[model samples]
Target: MEEKKLNELTNEELLVLKKKSKSTKVINASIIGFCVGIAGYSLFVAGITWPTIFPLLLAVIAYKYLGKNEKAVDAELKSRNLS
Candidate 1:
């Protein structure tokens, strides 16, 4: 699917995108927190091992996805001269 540029989005579309971006940010933070908790629990149960690192990896992926969404929102805001 073709993606529209931030500058090309209508105000209504921008509002939707903004809401989605905020939702994604919250979800990503939750994922990071959950992963950290899992990692800590794994460490306590199994010591420093591969399983302990897996959740950390997931957290990193979530963080990167979060950054991408945030950048899109920032671009939209910048295009609208709101930032």
Candidate 2:
């Protein structure tokens, strides 16, 4: 499908886009937090092991990707004077 430019989207569409962007950010953060909590529980309660590192790494990567997407959304909003 052809992608429409942000400027070409109607106001309602833009609002939906903005809401989705914010929701995605929240979801990513929640996942990262849950992972970190699990990793911590495994480390302190179950004892440290190689498997414990996996959740921590996953959380870090998720956080990094979330930041990148957030920057892109912020830039788009700024360029469009939407936020």
Candidate 3:
């Protein structure tokens, strides 16, 4: 589907998008935190292993994805002159 241009979006739509973005950020951060905790537990309890590496990998990927997505949302909001 074609996304609406920022200029074409209504104020309410922009606000909704902003709110959704905030929720998404929280979800991503929670996931990253959980993964890090798992990684740390596995590292200490089981030594170097796939369980430790996998969660660490997942955390890195999630962090990167979150950063990229946030930049997009922030840019959109900035362009719209909305916090």
User: Which candidate wins on lDDT?
Assistant: 3
Count steric clashes of candidate 3. 0
In candidate 2, list every pair of residues with a backbone clash: none
TM-score of each: 0.79, 0.72, 0.78
lDDT of 3 by residue, 1-83 (tens): 12446557677877787777778888999999999999999999999999999999999999987767457656777876787
1 versus 2: better TM-score goes to: 1
Candidate numbers sorted by TM-score from highest down = 1, 3, 2
Local distance difference test, candidate 1: 0.79
Q: Which segments of model 3 are wrong by more than 4 Å?
A: 1-8
Off by over 4 Å in 1: 1-4
lDDT of 1 by residue, 1-83 (tens): 12366667777777777777777777778989999999999999999999899999999988876677568767777777765
- The candidate, 1 or 2, that scores higher on lDDT is 1
| Total colliding residue pairs, candidate 1 | 0
Please identify which of the two predictions, 1 or 3, would achieve the higher lDDT against the true structure: 3
Which consecutive 10 residues in model 1 have the weakest lDDT in total?
Answer: 1-10
lDDT of 2 at 44: 93
